[model samples]
Target: MRIERKERADATILHADLDSFYASVEQRDNPALRGLPVIVGGGVVLAASYEAKAFGVRTPMPGREARALCPRAVVVRPRFEAYVEASNAVFDIFRDTSPIVEGISVDEAFLDVGGLARISGSPVEIATRLRARVAAEVGLPITVGIARTKFLAKVASAVGKPDGLLEVVAGTELDFLHPLPVRRLWGVGAITEAKLADAGISTVGDLSRFGEHGLCSLLGGGVGRHLYALSMARDPRRVETGRRRRSIGSQRALGRRPKSDADIEATLVAIVDRLGKRLRTAERVCRTVVLRLRFDDFGRATRSRSFLESTDRTDMIMAVARGLLDDAMPLIRDRGCTLIGLSLTNLDDHDSIQLTLPFEADHGAELDIAMDQLRDRFGRDAVTRAVLVGRHHGDDAPMLPD
Candidate 1:
């Protein structure tokens, strides 16, 4: 039997990404900050304006280093509420533009406009309108890339950044992607790029010529096959909406200074507290507690413990997370800790748990509910743990919906 493969005949996928999202929002709200180099967050650079980036400033860089790089840059604390409101407004516009919209993060999304050609005109027209709408309505600049495949669309958006629009027309995907450096590929990070460079493969065209067999021999089979497929423009992914997350997590950067055990434990408590509240709000329970640690040398380690049953109780999850942290303390002390993070994985809906008669009332559960109510009525600062009193926990970074 002979089978014919079917593919979309036109470029209909759009990768819309906001330019320097946090910094852009800061610039949009404050007229005085406009056209100036801006850096968000004081301890660690969360986001940098295009002007600051021109001077080699980047996110996650130490504030001290960034200041040295761009002396006149204006540093500001992140206003998460404003960023969230802006993200919601932009997503609303995305939904209005296309019924099939997949949100990647707070600042990026993939929109599929495959069947709207007759009514909405071409993909280029739709992308133009989307960019204009975001600038006029949200008062923020956004760049959009239109292509037949999601990978190519994302690549195009990256190539045409800082409020630009680019289109990779059908039948010209290879022409557009091959000349770019291998680093432009989605999964090629610093280590991978170094490895590719060692092999004398610098561009996508070089990678394609290396062939899948050669790549599999050079790299591992899974990664080699993935990159080879991308080099050939063979992505078949569809834009998905209403997707659920498998894990919920948060982290805090503790800077380069040495952190005492007490300080690290306190930070863990703060992260667990926030994650617990988020879990209950989303009506999800998790069965695994994972602790992530980064050392001053940039090496990373992870520790995790699974519970017998899924739980949304703050105390139970905290107990497990603390245990994992305790186990990792030796490594942390040896390497000198730089960051700590926690993740609740193996998630399931709260409704899925079977109800059982309790021998005794769950005081911890009651306390969690009470604290959540108090924070809801008042603000997040209304309720704080005794250990967290007078301690600066830093701002919570915004995340995509769990």
Candidate 2:
């Protein structure tokens, strides 16, 4: 039986993702790590090289488990500064390739090269040049996948990983996607995958045969309908340019270092200051402050505290974040922490929301606004929190969308 692809198709969406971003950068800079099982982040495994993955090593896995899997692996601490620099260089190339770009994270993005065929050449040609440029300029391996839809493009990129390229031609999407496992679909987590397996639906072809109504009955309406559409490669989303995200966040990998309370607090302050500036610049206010932590044992925890009113002030958000961190101090001390991240969520349009009534004024907001203006006029580093001063690695690393 033949499968039908979506009509009026064009393989224009390009999903470009870095291959083992952190590990690749480490190998690119250090010759000794090349072609070896190099793992970045000794505690939580932020990234594992393709060589390490061959030995059954995966990221976010326990350091002990990774060590056991790849006994000869070269373990190193993550350099957030280097990673951010490389990411900026790579993204410069992305902008050069296409005008419409959506950054998914520090390492991955979706670029729409639908037009510009005359100037940039075919989709494959554009992707080829993009890969070559990133390799030559950033010294990193990037995988590119070109397809008609964003979902298919992303899946194509994943299938062609560790420095490779794949393009799904129009009218041939099902031929490419059907044979892949159902887990390749976005919404299929371990639990859903287990359920699908129990239902004898292992591949996209099997799921398609089971039909949308049947799948809906099995997995509930919303997720089931979504997965059914994806299983058939029918994504209608476009590459969003300059998309304003609801939340802005940043994270740092601390590796196996022993951190004092003061050290952790300093890191938290730096993160809050950076994110607060981003939130304000986006003209958004957040009601929730989320603190994400990963322990030396590779266990992760997320704690969030909501304010009574939305805020864009760094001091106010930082106070709540600090309190959340304080509450998690026992766990951090017990487990030995490895990573820290902060995200501001539950966003509101700052222009629309009247944040301050005369009775509910924030005294610190004036200082916050002044600092933001100074940083905007001069540079992001123009105003720095005093607590982060003189500390090593406290310089603001470029915050990437994630």
Candidate 3:
């Protein structure tokens, strides 16, 4: 499951992402929630209605903080089954409109309508109709981006958010993209933006003027070339649908409170266990590890590492996840924790048993495998992490944004 980066910018594609998907769904279902700030998550903010967003409440924010921002906001727990049903309905619309639809997440997808121009109307028309239909039938706000390429379409959707529709005309892509901040570029993260800002390149226009050669020297050969081209509207990438997603990940809110080291470790192991089982079931091997942590103070951190070989072993993933957690111990201790997650990438189709290191043989791999099998045959609750058994004692602890 390789997610190929957009190599060119001429591929006609549209990326449609729901606005505050979970929270919007809840609000839509509950009449009393209309026009009120709504936050979704058990202990943390999984999604926030646009009304909450105006108050600076955001996903992954601690529930306490979200409440502080919008004192009158109503909080709701996530209804995953309801979300799945809504997502299926949305996908059904995508299928009827276009045959090439690529789902990026539960809330977002890319639609290829190059061949549907005559039957489905223009891309802009299709996007408008789709957005209205989603609101009418699914009772959710959806933002759409219609562009000549996937990257630009995704960027457009991001820019026109909270139930917006934006189109980057084929020839005016550069004009539309240049004024935005450098962070709007897909790969330009905090660190990269800092580097660009250090070089007096603050916007896409500035980066474009910096030229590919200069950017290559600043951002390495590969990134510099790709970004400069994107800035200049020279992308030629295609819309790839049905590409198997490389990873599946989940996180839980621990509530906005300090967690003991043991509690954190237990949570990490549980997440790794869940993700590892999914990887194994997919018959996929992942060579990269990703860790995400959210702190009580509303700060966020992420770390990733690449492995020489791919593996789906719980022990292996957990061991690496622990190492990553250890690396972030100082920050976690200082800020306290709210949420943690794990994801594996760089996936391959191979499902063969990988040889274990001599030291790893003692890492409880056998027991974990046995438990996964038994749980698969019996039920998820048949075997539970011992730490969770007595967690009621710590129930009074701070809550993370659920």
Candidate 4:
């Protein structure tokens, strides 16, 4: 047997971010939208293409407002499925580039390309290849930034936006960081920006000169110390792929169609079944169940419940979910539901969460594993509950990795 050991290298963190994620996908699939300002989502701007952004259009703004900014922009409904597919393909490229990848969202991640000096040329080489692969395979342009730490790498990527690459050489870290705005530092939101600007600290260089005590006095102890360090170009965090999300959720938009209680329950069942499969696949158990609803009037409501014990079992979780649904049945009846979403939170590792009941002794564990295997071998639509027979909830949306 032969064994090979991996080693770390200097300046190996690379931040890869998809440019204009949702809008990019819209343009990529529809050639007519190419080089044209595109906006995804009708009620609110979910994403704006680089072209639309150039017109001062921003995401999460009111759809009417976005259109007002750029009346020429092509508006399209959000296809979560397509976005998920693109996200998964792009993430696959990320994993292929490095074994250590910390996903920030469906669109961006921090990849550690350290210790690939022998197999891969350098951090710059790895990022270049990764970007090329994503463009070729997924048909999306991605920006990459290379630095010694995750923060700088992410900042570099943001600075080099709209399909660009930037490398912050180790020796020139401060020279590069100091010239930027204070808002570029992590945790410096609108309020922080205002505070810093009020203090005459318009740039990172100004904040860097402001001693930690003054910053602490200006921003309070916790946030003050943190920003001071980032201003000084110091970040010790590394790429961590094992840090799973607090919850895994899926939702369906049924538009203004009126659905009966039975129909709603069936839809919820489909979401629960699929999410249950996802929960178990991630080796996680949840203690809380959250139900989110959007009514025909465009109003939203969320209801949640927590259990004494954490569980990964579908039937067990479904019971709790159904209970939540029943509790909100009156609201649904009055409001006329248009969208349904469910999220399982309060997650704990399956290994760390001891079984309160003899689930395996009851033979439920065997059945769950059996169904999972069948689904894996076949498809997600392979195994379903009795209620789902001859019923359609919605198409399966693309998903982020477990």
Best first by lDDT, ranked = 1, 2, 4, 3
What's each prediction's clash count? Answer: 0, 0, 20, 0
lDDT of 4 by residue, 328-377 (tens): 99999998987778889888889977646555557666788999999999
lDDT of candidate 2 over 178-277, digit per residue (tens): 9999999998998999999999999999998888899999999998899999988888776787766667777776667799988888988888887887
User: How well is each residue in 113-151 modelled by candidate 3, as lDDT tens digits?
Assistant: 776666877788888899888888888889998888778
Q: What is the C-alpha lDDT of each candidate?
A: 0.91, 0.86, 0.80, 0.85
Best by TM-score: 1
Which ten contiguous residues of candidate 3 have the minimum total lDDT? 393-402
Runs with alpha carbons beyond 4 Å of true place in candidate 2: 1-8, 252-267, 277-284, 293-301, 326-340, 347-363, 366-402
Candidate 4: how many backbone clashes? Answer: 0
Please give the distance, in angstroms, between residue 176's alpha carbon in candidate 1 and its true position after superposition.
0.2
- Native-to-model Cα distance after best TM-score fit, residue 40 in candidate 3, in Å: 2.3
Off by over 4 Å in 1: 1-7, 399-402
Error (Å) of candidate 4 at residue 20 is 1.4
Off by over 4 Å in 3: 1-11, 42-44, 62-64, 189-203, 213-223, 286-335, 350-379, 390-402
For residue 220, what is the lDDT in candidate 3? 100
Q: For model 2, what is the alpha-carbon lDDT of residue 43?
A: 59
Roughly what TM-score does model 1 have, to 2 decimal places? 0.95
